[model samples]
Target: MIKGTVKIDAKICKGCELCIISCPQDGLGLAAQFNDKGYRYVELIEDNCTGCVNCALVCPEAAITVFRQPKPAKKSVEKK
Candidate 1:
């Protein structure tokens, strides 16, 4: 599994829910509170993330960024 994190650029978000419907994992959503611009911005429910990067793909402003954690190192097998 990828260790993924989603970031919402509050300055650029227009409170639209298009990314919400586009996310296959339901990883992204609209915030209940409004920002300084008097508009609601998107936020991430990090625990539910599947790292598909769907939110980034759907964002019109290219404001979202997803960071994936590197894979864990595999253990070496011992000779029997």
Candidate 2:
């Protein structure tokens, strides 16, 4: 499985749910606390992330950054 993590710049977030809706794994949520601008930031909730970067693409403020682990390579069998 492809594993990944997300880093959200809470200060830059504008309380937009675009990232939440763009995530396929539902890994994002609104935080209980508020930012400097009084807008709740995005937080990671579920662990079913696939590093699809959908959230980052939809974020108008560019407050989200996704880090994805590389997938394992397949091995080939030699013919005897």
- TM-score of each predicted structure versus truth: 0.77, 0.85
Expressed as tens digits, the lDDT of each residue in 6-26 for candidate 2 is 999998999889988888888
Whole-model lDDT values for every prediction: 0.78, 0.86
lDDT of 2 at 63: 83
Best by TM-score: 2
Model number with the top lDDT? 2
Which sections of candidate 1 miss by over 4 Å? 72-80
RMSD in angstroms between candidate 1 and the native structure over all alpha carbons: 3.5
- Candidate 2's TM-score: 0.85
Candidate 1 residue lDDT tens string, 2-67: 557888899888878888898877777778889888879989864777667888898887988888
Clashes of each: 0, 0
Q: Relative to the unseen true structure, what is the C-alpha lDDT of residue 14 in candidate 1, on a scale of 0 to 100?
A: 87
